[model samples]
Target chain A: MAGGTEIVAHRSGIEKAVAGLILVACAFYCFHALGLNFGSLSNPRSGFMPSVIGVSATVLAAVNLVLTLRKHRMAEADEVALDRYTALNLLMALAGTIAFLVLLDLAGYVVASALYLLFLTKLTRSPGWLVPMAVSIGATGFFYFCFVMLLGVTLP
Target chain B: MENFALLMQGFQASLALHNILAALAGVTLGTLAGVLPGIGISGTIALLLPISFGMEPLTALIMFSGIYYGAMYGGSITSILVNVPGEGASVVTMIEGYQMARRGRAGAALAIAAIGSFVAGTLGVVGITFIAPPLAQVAIAFGPPEYFAIAALGLLVLTNLSGGSALRAVLMMLIGLMLGTVGMDYMTGLVRFGFGVDGLGDGLDFIVIVMGVFGLGEVLARICERQNDVRVTKIKFKDLYPNREETRRSILPIFRGGLIGAIMGLIPGPSGTISTFASYALEKKLSTRREEWGKGAIEGVAGPEAANNAASSFTMIPLLSLGLPFSASAALLLSGFMIHGIQPGPMLVSTEPVLFWGLIASMYIGNLICLILNLPLVGLFASVLRAPMRYLMPVVALVTFTGAYVLNYSLFDLGVLTFFGFLGFFLQMSGYSLAPLALGAFLGPQLEQGLIQTMVLTDGNIWTLMTRPLAGTALWLGVAMIGWMIFRFIRQLLRRSSSQPVAEDV
Candidate 1:
């Protein structure tokens, strides 16, 4: 129970930290926006809307942060177990896509796409490795045929 | 009478062999896509957009319209049978529809939903066919201030009614607006926030951002959660029709839901979802079998499903008449129109009568097709719901990436897509709705252009915007809506504080 509470606290802390990062981003946006020329109201300039948006975003983020913190402070922490296995899989999924994007630029589209699919299918652990492999091959072949052969997408 | 003649011509154009084939293919693919959990109509359309690129404008549009109705049909199947809403609008259906399924009334529930959708969808198309032209005529007289007011109301209404904290929704919208400002300022020809990056100069691609935020974000979110097993009852064709009693119970709800949905559709925000909720609430209040609502009631399934379908069709009004997209799906359709080199607005009716009326006529055909396709194929689509997320998510991710890539073929655009995907996931995790953000991204430029144009015309008198009759009324209504939302939010917060101190879920 103590460990659960600690985990809840940790998650809350992460939330607050992210909220703080939003504030920082808004601040940076405002600062950067100031460099652009802000013309008069009748004749708006490049920075007019950006500056307004940045300030508004900053204020709203601040209010949300305060409300969140107050709510957190007022309540007893109840932990929901974070599914680390799924989380890791999700992370790997993200990594796999990023890798695919890079490899698509380096290797050809088919090779990169097939590899990405194989990796994702293995992670799924569905009917079996063979089925997934066949599915992956089929998916790639279909996409290639439809997009490149038929439509002439000129995919790199 | 002229409109009728034009519509007849449109039907003539649309009934061609190839167009019919395109519509059939679109609805089939759309229904299947909708059956697949987590892939919504917007995401599905975005994924399939590349394929439509080579086709003629009318043919492609007919296909898209088909997909729109078909996807709605597909969503209700999952919501009823599996208790997993395929998209936002079908969430209400899951409540009582799932219960009915559990009670061995899945067939009746599914049939009622399908029939209700067909009726409501056809009614909505009828409304659109008649109402849109006159609305466009009124819109033709609108000035920059009017545009500004309408755009503002659309954004404000969307944010307020997005089923979240108004403050958070507004913040997300502001962020989206800021992101929308990331490219060249067309007024002064000055780049605002590109920061010397070559790719940023042209601005972010709407499709890429949509694919990332909606498509990839949903996939990632699902992947991060533990998978749950879902069971759908095997349904035979003989069990497809509702009994006489069930049909009798459903009639009033379907009509009432359709009316409510059509009315809600005229306003922006999450109209489809909002209409379903409104229908459910109204039906529950008026139902003789009110006690049977959460347990399982024909009215419950009938009303919301009808409302959702009706709203989905009529929500295209603002887009067709006023050149404003009220929702993300409308925004995608707007992008589609643009891709075809056709601007959809008041001028659309006159300038491109064929495209305009053809698209409208296609809706009627599409609804009929959905009814025909869904009735027998609900079983097949229900089977699709059982596909593992592990296999599904990866394909979804690939489609999103490829869709984003095909838009501009820029690596920098890919980076923007990835950034927005991560940002969208985090924002959703924090309980912020994405609809407002997408709306802001869509309406931001229109709002800015209107403001600037109004200012130029009025010589800096912002007060003049409030002087125009229609524009002023809309602007004031938007303000009042926001004020009411803020007040309600405060009251809810106070009540929560006074009652039970709850942990911040984020």
Candidate 2:
């Protein structure tokens, strides 16, 4: 049972592999986008340093993949455990957060955030209309006190 | 003698009504943030940094510093009650602390943590007072080359710090270092990875990268995970303060932690974090009653709590003395010094004696204030977990993004926050420690500036990194540490090999 857990983890290695690849690829994008030449002092190209990082990220991914595969092999003996609901909650939270950030400028911080909170709380297992309303109104009011009144921070 | 007088002046100023109020406000906000899940004090501080623009530098810094230390004190509140750690620094505390709470000993754990924090924090501040000035004296003699060596030594923590895979840690560190090099070449005034965006001209603001990777990224991931609903148990008032028997059990740990924290703080790397972890391991390793450790043994809570506070104080040693930041918060403090146009290195003792010694003296006062406040408010802070995440997260978001906009009134940094937040989330998912990545980004530009200047001065002698005696000695020490790590790893491997066959046979 314990061993099977690691096998479960190995399944998630694809994510790491993908992420590392993206990081590395982004490095190439960053590399091509820069101008590195200067006068006679002759500095290293901007992309040169970044490419090194990109390659390093790629290497890290390869290693991660290897570890993941190895863990998968051991999964039969030692299975990893994951909490599904916890993971699901995290996903909803992320989506809600992204929507909040994207639309905050248009809707304004207080209004946009209220919608984000209202939506997330309602979607979660604790979905009470009161919970979302209280959370949204409370969040806006607190921000108003600290950022608006006390700190005099002008909201976007 | 002059330093002593200046410390006195600083003490007086730190205690002034406005500064004290700021410290109180910082602690209140810090505790609220610490008690809440998914929100961190760093993001909060980043949010408020711009508000200080209109205020006097002293008042502003005093408030931020309070926010900083207050968060540390408050972070334990969350970890002890709920199984979730509100901040990374308090992760270890949550382990034993929640276990203690489960065993119906929440009061005991809280008492030990608060008391130990007070004791170690006081001693740690004393260590800062004595250790910092002399270190500053030595730093005064340092050139850019020496600075580079020190910075390198700090960055190398990525390897030893990687709990699982050293190679991966090194890989992450190198990647982070390269990321640091992105943006404008300060010396040449030329853009490196700016991509012709006018915004890229200044290079990526470390704040943006840091907030994104740690703050926004973490939020995104947290939002997705189905979390346990917040539950904070009540604490009886009588049980809030540790009695003599409990205090006696905790004494040795607090003392040990104080000493360890002081020494670690003086080192160039992320000493505070390492010290806290090491203190916990040491407590567990040395305890005759080992089983009690995971069960929320008072010593377990006491030792690491003390270590954490002590480390916080000692961090100032490097920041105030060498102007070399060894942690993320310390780097930000260094930035604060630069913002105030007070270079925090050797010259601090000479040029800004009042401000410098005042801060040092204020550390002592601050510790006292923490003690006075923490014991009475344990339950209050613990109860903060009752608030819903839906309510908590938005306030945090508004503060952070609003804080970003106020910097240059640019929405771009907010984008940086989202991007880095996702990145931080991914890194967290993959078991990559964002500590090194973040500190690297923060220190990268400074390290670059130092290295470029040092190289030019030496006429392209890469060997200069080695030849300089003081720096050379530090380099050798690093080599020795590596050698020792290899030895330990081999020994561990052999032990595991021998045990493997036995385990298989069993």
Candidate 3:
């Protein structure tokens, strides 16, 4: 029960943080949209729709953040603990994808994709290195044949 | 008689050798997508949109239609066998279907679902054949005000019905609309939020955002969970038939559910999922053996499965006739159509009668193909569940990367994909629905165009714009929907506050 409470508290914290981030995004969007041409309603310009949407979103996000804070207060702020395993797994996958992007520029599609798959398969705790290696290489080859050879898609 | 002749012409076109092969490949891939838990119909269609660039528009559309309904058939397999629904529509089936699986009546449940899907799906095609032409005729009269009203109503109804906090759904939708404004303004040709990036000149690609959110985001979410082997229920070939009593019981429910779905599908919301739940409730009420519902009633499996398939077929009417997508999957299908340089709307019937009628005709063939494929191949499809996630997720991630890169060969698009992927993951985690976001992005331009055109036509008098009959009714409906959401929201807050003191005291 205590562990469950802690998890809920941690989730509440994350929710509040997300709400805050969205609110900030909405603000930035509004500011950026305002800088563009705000043509009159009779003949609305490019920025008109964005400005309207940004303002509405900013208001809604603010309300969401307030509601989240109120809910957090109502819950009495139990002990906060993160799900480290899930977090770490998500981080690894994201980092690996970003690394793939960089490597695709530095190396090439073949090497970057193969390494990305290898890293992800291992991260998923495939039985051993051999299986991950085989799966990654085999899958990369299939993708290459399908995309490049058959579909005539050029890959860098 | 003219419609009949046109439909016959459609049959002739769809029966061509290549179209048949296209339909075959589509259903097969669609089934695979439905069986796989990680990716869904939206992701699959989005992935294939780029690949379909080279095919004839008719062939690509035929294939997409096959995938659309084939997925409905395939989703039931996982729900019944492994107790995990492959998609949202199959969730209802998992209840009694999984229970039936536990009782070793899995074969009967599977057989009934396939039969029901085929019957309802065919019925939906017949409905579309007669109804969509007239609907398109009526839609041709719609002007800017009406279009704006319909689009606003769609966004409102979807966010209201998208199964979360209405505020969160609206927020996601607004954000999507903002994203839609990032590229060139069609009316003015001015880039609103380009941030000096050359890639923003054409605007954010819809397929790229969809791939990131649905494909890569789903993979990220799945890999974060602990990998566990799924236990699939085994069935012999001989056990595949439903017995006499079960077969008789399912017939009425199948028809009843099909009618319910055909009607619901016309509404602008998640009709596929909603219709299944509605059918289940209706069947529960109508069943004499109500006690068997939660336990392994064959009717429970038959009705919802039929309803979802029927709903999937009927949902295409709006997309085909009005060029508006009410659901996420339909939106993706609309994107597929646009990618092939085919715009589906009122003029489509007159301008591209062959493609329109051919696609409709292909649905009939596709539904028949799904029925034939699902029955004998259930075992093979069920085997897909046994494939470990460790091997599958990496492959999915790689495909997403490759597909995104191939779209424009732009590395900037890949960056956009990754950004949206992460954004989608976090937003989903925070309890925001992505359907409205996708739908909003898709509809944003249409909505803005309609509003601008109407304003200019009415000389900036928004009231005159609202006074038009069809537009007025649609706008009123949107307002009523908003009022209902607010009422529900306040009631929930009040209930929560009332309950809080009791919890504290306890």
Candidate 4:
């Protein structure tokens, strides 16, 4: 029973955090939209739609936040929120992706992609070094042939 | 008769060697994507959108349509053999299908699903051939006000039906609309929210967001999941044919499911998934072999499978006629058309007759190809499930990154892709539906454009804009939907409160 309570709390906590984030984002968007031109109703300018969207979103977010605080049932999370290990997996994958981007700029597609693939394969717990290495190299080669050789895309 | 003649011309056009090859490749790739649980039709199409850049618009669209139809067939394979639904629409199929598989009728389940998909899909195409032209003809009469009202009604109906809090869907949609505003203001030639970034000048590319959210976002989500060993049921090629009893039973359900799907597909919000559930319930209720339900009933598999495919075909009606996409996959298809400098709507029938009719005609061929491929190649496709996610995810990530780069050859776009990929992952984790966001971003400009045009036409008298007949009806419908949602919410709250006291007393 305590475990069930803990799970519900954790779920609600995530929902509240998401609602808060949305509220902040919408507020910022509304502020930015306000800085743009506000033309007349008949002949609106560039900022008209943004302003309307931003303000409406801000209001909606605020309502959502209130609903969350009141413990009213809102949108139930479709998938389970990340646990500690899964969160770690996500962070590692994200870091690997960012690193791949940096590497691509410094090196080339083949080198960057190969290294990224190797890291990801290992991150997903590929048994040993041999399989990850083979997959990374083979996949990079296939991509090179498909994109550059066949499609004539100049990959950075 | 004229429409038939045009359809004949379309058949001639689609019969080209290149178009046939495109159809073949699309269905094959789509089936493979469907068999793999990690990716879906949206991700596959997003990943391949860049590749389609070099092809002619007709060929590209034909391939996309083929992929759409093929995924339907492929999704059933995983559901039957592994008890894992490959897509949302196949969930019901897994109930009876896996049971059948366990009873050594896996081949029959798969065969029935394929045949049902083919029959329903062809029916849907025939419906499109007859119904869509007339729908487009009517849509051609819509003014800016009516367009605005239609867009508004679509978003409202979708939010209500999208299976979550209406508030959450609306919020996501607003965010998407805000994102759509990032680029240049088309009418004024003034940039609204560029943030002084050079990439912001042209606004965010729809395909980039799609690839990031559907492709990379999916990968990120999958990585966090605990990998389970998938056990595939082996099938003898000889057992692929359904017995006479099974075949006879499936026939009516297939036609009935197809009819349900064809009608529901014309509505908004995940019609394919909805229609399948509806079909499943109806079949169970109407079945003579009621005791077999939830066991190894062939009708259970046949009905929902047909409904989903038929629904998929029907979903194209709104997109092809009104230039509106009611679902995520349809939105991707719309992007495919847009990328080719084509807009699908009333004007398309007149302006791009060959392309319009050709796409419709190609569905016939695509459905045939899917049926043929699914039967003989079931073993080959099912083997894809055995590939470990550890190796597969990396390839997906690399392809995503590579595809993002090829779009504009800009590092900025890659950065945007990464940003949205993470954003999508987090948003999905929070239980936000990404479909509304995708549709919002896609429709934001059109919605804004319509609003502005209506305002201009009505000379700032907004009420006058609503006074227009078609526009008035659509707006009223949206209002009624919102009212209904509020009433339902209040009723639920009251019921919960009442139930709580009874529970405490007990």
What are the models' TM-scores? 0.95, 0.86, 0.96, 0.95
Query: Candidate 2 docking category?
Result: acceptable
For residue A128, give model 1's deviation from the true position in Å.
4.7
lDDT of 1 by residue, B21-129 (tens): 8898888888887877767777777766766767889998999888888888888888888888888898999999999998988988888998999999999999999
Query: Which 10 successive residues of model 2 chain B have the least lDDT summed?
Result: B497-506
Q: Which candidate gets the maximum DockQ versus the true structure?
A: 1
Pairs in clash, predicted candidate 4? B183-B203
* DockQ of each two-chain model: 0.53, 0.28, 0.48, 0.43
Worst 10-residue lDDT window, candidate 1 chain B:
B497-506
The TM-score-based order of candidates, best leading, equals 3, 1, 4, 2
lDDT of 4 by residue, A45-111 (tens): 7778989999999998998887666653433443346566676777787787888889999999999
lDDT tens readout by residue for model 3, B1-506: 98889999999999999999988888887887778785667877776666665689999988988788677767888899988887778899999999999999999999999999999999999998999999999999999899899889989988877776788899988988887887888887887778899998889988899898887788888776668998999988899999999999999999999999998888877888899999999999998998788998988999998998888889889888899999888999998888789999988998999989998999999998888877998898888888898788778778888888887899889989998888878776766789888988889889999988988888788888667899998988888888998898788778877785321110
Candidate 2, B287: how far from true, in Å?
Answer: 5.1
Worst 10 residues of 1 chain A by lDDT: A1-10
Residue B236 error for model 3, in Å? 1.9
Question: For chain B alone, what TM-score does every candidate structure achieve against the true structure?
Answer: 0.95, 0.90, 0.97, 0.96
